[model samples]
Target: MANERWNLNTTSDLTAEPGTPVGLVNQPRTAAQRLTDRPSDYGEQIVPPKPLWYLDKAGEPHSLGVNEPHQFLLFWRSNVGDKAADLDDSYYMGVTGLQGVGVAGHRVTINATGEVLQPGGESSATISGFWDKSDPDDPMWTPIEPETEYTVTVAAHNQSGEFGPDSDELTITTPAVGYDTQQLTLPPRPPNDVDFAAPLPVITTSGGGGIQLRWTTVPNVTKYEIFDNPTPGTTDGMDSSRPGLNSRDVKLGEVNQPSAGTPTVTFTTPAYTTPRRRFALKVRAVRTNSYGTAYSEFSTPLRGALPASTVAPGTPGAPTLTVSPVVGGQVKLTISPPTINASNGAPEYYAVYDGTRQVAVVSSPLGAAPHVTLQYAAAQGYSFTVAAGNSVGVSNPSSALTGTVPTPAAPGAPTAVAVTNVTTTGLAVNWTAPASANPPVTSYKVYDGSTVKATVAAPATTTNLTGYSPQTAYSIQVAAVNGTGEGSKSSPAVTGTTPAT
Candidate 1:
């Protein structure tokens, strides 16, 4: 092929008036501009088309785009002013450099190709490629001022390395991500629209299980940042770090929620000893997934509303449930009008009190009157209280209301107790054939000295020595008893175990 240089005129007409934070205008061309080649009088008219532009990631060009991501602009024009065949589907893109623009050095950029995008090219060629800041003068280093308009022109090269001539140039503005527009600069806007809400859904469950959150949707949000702060001992349910505190300062935990529309957040809390726990949670729109994390403003704090347990009622409605003289046993209890009465049941909570301190509390459903119980054993002075469980927590114990569980008659001393030593099975056959054993000796209440060792039935005499595998010495006894009749315990127990033989 003979060496030849086809002279081609190239230009465009896109303009960025002024004070506009200039950036890539990535719009496609119009059909009219692609259909007919128009002629102009001021010489700022339509001209011949240009070649396509592609990203070449080799040892040629490299630059970060809008989001500072590793991507470049791509442009292509016709070799002949005529509509070019489907050349778009013919090529792809890469990284590094293409044409003559690339990373000149670390911070500086370089672009030297006799091309400075001017406003004269038609509205068709989409410019896409390297964008560098450092410019070096190997060939011709021309510094492109940020926010300045420049022209990019493309030319067609034949397969055998021949020029099809110059194509029309497209105009574009270059602006670093931060350069602002006049005075109304773009405030830190989330990458795209973010979905969120003030006072969003918040909740806490039994035992500080976890805090849950949910919100609205956003178009281009990648992830969500959730925050929580403890409003310890707070009576008013408000989600916030007491005023003037940094979110982190008031932070309980930060959670990452999905940006898939539904605004949901959650953070688990540690175990709780107190009857009730409370907290405040807030949400912020964020996106760490993209090159530059796009973040939306924080939503107002939303105090999670937990189901507050209500206070137990006074004066039993149902049959009086005798609290087994045992500690930690609860009983079915409820307030007067089971329904919450804003007036009387307004803030009260159900608690089993032992004169001074409260032993148990129903701390949720703040108004529901449900069964409540005394967690501790009956002390000399003990009574129940449908105490208020509110901002100030369960109110001072309810009442030492004249209540008493008649002390159980000293259980009649057990009777007819008996015992035997078995050498063959290495077992203690202790039993009581008391006449009261008709009720089926529930268990032969046995004791080693004053300490109760074992409680077995008399009918079932042979007490297996499994617990004491080796020939360990043992003392055992038995007693005959029924729900109503407890008999005298067996006399001093006989010793036996896994035989020495």
Candidate 2:
């Protein structure tokens, strides 16, 4: 097909030709017509909106104490006409720099975007990216000095990568460390007077065997530091070489300036069992102001001993004794321990007494049963008592108990039987009871050779046998009688010779 040109003037006329070549009729239009026909070309470069300002904490500007950190909050509209669809690509906020205005002035960049000129082309000063508030991590500026004025500004970038106008500067100042130099005076040290009235360095018994200490307050003192030592005179002769005279001493605690109606500060001693723990205490007063802190010299060392707790275990209950059968001339005794005092501490041990004398000491009452074995004769009786003891002291003795040694079989022969008070016609015989008598001897029988001489009641140490020939020697023997019957005669009969006139 041969190419031919068609002169179609308007879009309507060009569409009317059916067999006309589409490419020939379709031709590029002039720039002016294209510009007029196109969507009017109303688009322009986007500019970031100005940011609204606020303090990081309180909405209004506030004073910062010495060493306080400065922070701010800046927020702006990120959307532009056509760029509003791309929020992440459209805009970003930056803190330019903090400028200190006047004497002792300086400048520090808080946020930057790598631009050689100032951020947002606002200033010619150098910039930095040391801190960025938009960053979640490490989002704080370098702290400023107290008593200084600063102007903080922020800039925003649009999708075209161009920073718009800077936000209005916010002026702030950190507060000064305010105090009157003259008011910073050292407080007077506590007095060394041992007689400084009650409640001042007063020592009292604390609950659970401890000591409590209290002291009066000094005027204009903001804090009081206390020192304590086990040795007396430790605070004496302290030189400048030892800056803190009581440096060796332990610091108990500090007392801050008390509120109204509270006149004294008290320290309760820790729970301890050591009796009479002598403590040397010294107190120094301190005050702080713009001139700094001042400490007074340590007061005179006051010594006091910790008193024992007044609460004590109650008296022990009566003890019971159980005697065992005698074996080999000895008897065994088992004692039941006493009950403990519920209101106070338990006893340390028990004192076992035989009559008025303390015979043994049982260290633990709740441990093994208090078992004791003692050598005893059948005729002898024993009395026992018990008393509880503790760190404080011993308690009163419990009720007394009486026991006797047990014996088996008949009574044994009497011992130490002899003849005394010899005369011309008569002589007296003296004897003692058997050592191991089960039923206990009721009477005694005296014999002259093979003939029964006389009978006497039991426990009769002396007996007279008259009608004896003078200058004659007679053989005599004694026998013990019990409820069962008479026991064997005494061995080795004693020979008695009466003197002739």
On lDDT, the candidate that comes out on top is 2
- The candidate that achieves the highest TM-score relative to the unseen native structure: 1
Evaluate model 2: give its TM-score.
0.25
Per-model TM against the reference: 0.32, 0.25
Per-candidate total of colliding backbone pairs: 60, 0
Task: Give lDDT per model, in order.
Answer: 0.40, 0.54
Model 2, residue 144: C-alpha shift (Å): 38
- Residue-wise C-alpha lDDT for candidate 2, range 330-417, written one tens digit per residue: 6565655444434544455677788988777765424245666666676567787777666666777777777665554667788777
User: Which tens-of-lDDT digit does each residue in 1-501 have in candidate 1?
Assistant: 122111122122233533433444335343244224333322321222234433234422212223112222433433232432343333323111223221111111113343323232222222333343244344343444555555555443322223333434445566555332211222233223223333322222222224334455444454555555655334544437444345343544444545465544444433322224444555555555335555566666654444343442222122133443322223334443123332322333455554556555654443233555443323333455545454434344433444443322212334444344545434454343554332244555666556666666545654543344456566765555555456565555565455665
- TM-score (C-alpha, index-matched) for candidate 1: 0.32
